[model samples]
Target chain A: MTDLAARQAELVRALLADGPVPAGFDPDRVRAEAAALLAKRRGVAARLRPDLAATLGDRFRPLFDTWARENPRRAGESFRADLDAFARWLQERERQERERRSGHRLD
Target chain B: MGLPTLGVGIGWRSEIDLTVERLPGVDFVEVLAENVSPDPLPESLRVLRGRGVPVVAHAVSLSLGGAEPVDPRRVAHLAAVAEAVDAPLVSEHVAFTGAGGLDSGHLLPLPRTREALDVLVRNVRAAQQDLPVPLALENIAALLEWPDGELSEGRFLAELVERTDCWLLVDVANLHANATNLGTEPGRFLDELPLERLAYVHVAGGVRHGDLYHDTHAHAVPPEVLEVLGELCSRVSPPGVLLERDDAYPPDAELAAELAAIRAVVSR
Candidate 1:
């Protein structure tokens, strides 16, 4: 890749993923910018998957933020994929919580 | 060529189709190019076209600033939509949406360096070759800037316009957000633009999140953004002005009131 292309890609990775901020950029500001981008993504996802949004209720934004940190959005992928992945994550968390509660009750 | 005077309009989103269709004063509607299907245009959009209201194909995924050459398939889709709608023009952002196989999910800023400018100009020229109508580029609201920027946003955009001879889709709310977040003067930025190339203006709402002003079209048009729109009208009466509300849609009366507000400013 050309220097410009490589630099651009690095900057994007840093913004979308938790990659290091490219040299000479302010880390705090970039973090703020990334947070803003994720917030916008949550809004779009909410519109696209209103069912998941309603089921998650007020937990949507925070839960989406957690899911987004681990899964950088792929190019040309639909919001349905993200919605499905988030739904699975929520289910898994609930199952684990239920297992722990059952264990405590048996004890 | 400049666009004809399209008095006042709103972006046509499927969520607010009924409100947009019922609204009385809207002169035109902009549909996202990606959402449209040429083989079978949506019924609501067909109704608007039937009513003699101009429908503009506005694209969000054209990533014109990406290092790669413009995608031929995306360009083809935009052309098909424009032809299907009989649109006079299409619009996309001056920013990149994704790169390196990862989608940013939002428009991201490009470094104002000469290399980035070269990439943008080449991509735009390539996209223009296939587009049935002229492509107007809108400046985005970026929260961060690159350390290697060699030019101001206005100068870079002016140069891009001069080189490509593309029309400008000036977004007043975006200008306000940049001015508020980046410490640039919105009026001064407008002054630096090539006014003759202005094809239309976009007025939207934004809210201040802490110190940063988010140009969230989902909110109400703040008074400061309206002032920026008023200032733009005073400087140059653009051929068209549009209000874009993506989510958190208010009532039909609220939407009508916003359109009336823009009309009042433009007619002044």
Candidate 2:
């Protein structure tokens, strides 16, 4: 890849993916920026689906953060679709947690 | 070619659709290109357009500065929206939104190296060719500055304009945020910029978080940002000035007051 293409790719990976900050750039600022981007997603998600925020309540951020790590928004994915996917993810997690508890009770 | 006079305007959001209609002295309004469909323009937008108010299409996901070539579909959508709304011009950010397999879902900053500028210029020209109306590029608020920059933001924009002859949508809130967060001299940026090519100006509110100013666009336009707008107005009377409030839907009274404040600055 050309130097420009490589740098742009690395920068995007560093920001959205869990990739290392490219050389010469400020690591702290890059990391801070990544966090800020996630924070922005959280804000939009909460506003988009207040029911999710209310249902999850205190667990919303932690759960959303987990879902976000596993699912970095795909290129060109609309915010609304991403949030709906998060709702599905949360429901699946809740089902698994219930199944695990029920299996323990059977023991 | 000269630009149309847009006068004072506000960003049109679905949440505050009624509020925008109620507000007075609104010469025009901008609609997010991604949010509207040209085939059937939203009722709110139709009402505004029916009143003979101009609507400008502002797109967020163009990824204009990405290494990848500009997406033809995205450019096509922006063009269709502009035609539907009868916009004088359409605008997108100078920053790239996402790249590779992941989407940041927010406007991301670009490195100021010559190599990056070359890629950006190529991508911008490609999209500009497809756009139906004149394309205006806006300066985004960057929280992180990449290392080993070759050109200042102003010089980079000036050169890009020189190469393509696109218009500029200067966002003063972003200027304030960059100055506070990355020490970018807003004054020097304006001086270096070719203000004659300005299409319009964006004025939004932001909150200072810890050490950085977050261009949230959810709060009232701060005095520091207004000062930056005043500075730009002093240099050149921009054809338009817009107040953008994205998330927190304020009351009609407050929205009118903010619009009035922006008018006061440019009216001078």
Candidate 3:
């Protein structure tokens, strides 16, 4: 793999290290799309708020793109709900990160 | 009869209650029903009324174009608030905010199709029937476009108003944003639209992304939108026009300055 590809894979690996890649998630595809998205503009991905970038990297792009393609016009609410879930998931991940560093879970 | 020519009115807020109460030259206050309590009207509205300020209710959460059933409870709430304030009209967005059971955190556009038109007409009719005064639907700033748009936004709006006999609340900022984003001419869009039906106009600021524009409402109104609104005022000369400042609020002086710019244009 190219150096950029290798670094991109490593980032994805670090993000997904908590568990097996969740069902229906393709880390390779996410990395590929992220790379392509980055290639179109060097700092484009970085411009996204960190939390949103990480969530899109890990969960949203895969879920919504798939759901939106399959359902087309019918996917209006479903598409939005999936993105909201992705944002909420990112919030949880940030909370977990804070907890791990603090030596106590929030719950 | 239509609403009278109320000079410059700012988007109503509770934080500025004292300012609104104490001010002498203010024309009308657009009360946000979403910000008020669920119960009938409150003392704040009473204060505006007592101060001899005409109050109009503007709704933010109606999701008028959503696929879900219109929330009768919320409509009832709006009706009660309108009655309480003795508002002349109640306005909501043409776009849907909540979809697929999730609040999108934004106003999304409906595709310009016959089906979408039918849906908008039905929703507007429902709101008009439930509310106390004439129902007004405002144009929205859309981030995306449908693949099969069959009509221009202005024409779509004209058709909706005609079908439902409803009034239009033209948000010039949104019109400008769509023009820049969609590669259309803002003046052309305004020329084609039925300007006479406009009951109110909204002007706000936005952010731009490479060839696209986003209506962030975080700054002073851009000159392009102000120009279109000026044209609207002369052509239609609507009763009330309100400036929508949802983010990065400038000081009252700055806002008043912007309002003055609009007044100078419309008055000319």
Winner by DockQ between candidate 2 and candidate 1 = 2
Taken over the whole model, the C-alpha lDDT of each candidate is 0.88, 0.90, 0.65
Q: Considering chain A alone, what is the TM-score of candidate 1? A: 0.85
How well does each candidate superpose onto the true structure, as a TM-score?
0.94, 0.97, 0.71
How well is each residue in B1-268 modelled by candidate 1, as lDDT tens digits?
Answer: 5577777999998888878999989999999989768879989999999999999999988899998666788889999999999998999999988877788878888999999999999999999999989999999987887888898899999999999999999999999988987787887889899999998999999889788898888899998988999999889988999999987889999989999988988888
Could you say which candidate leads in DockQ? 2
Least accurate 10 contiguous residues by lDDT in model 3 chain A: A37-46
Which parts of model 3 have CA positions greater than 4 angstroms off? Answer: A1-107, B22-24, B38-42
Against the native chain B, each candidate's TM-score is 0.98, 0.98, 0.92
For this target, which candidate reaches the highest lDDT against the unseen true structure?
Answer: 2
lDDT (Cα, tens digit) per residue for candidate 2, span B1-268: 8879999999999999988887899999999998889989989999999999999999998999988777789999999999999999999998887777678888988888888888888988899889888999999998889888899999999998998888999999999999999999989999999999999999999898799898999888999999999999889999999999998777789989999999899988
* Candidate 1 CAPRI assessment class: medium
Model 2 scores what on Cα lDDT?
0.90
**lDDT tens digits, residue span B205-235, model 3:** 8777665666766677888888878767767
TM-score of 2: 0.97
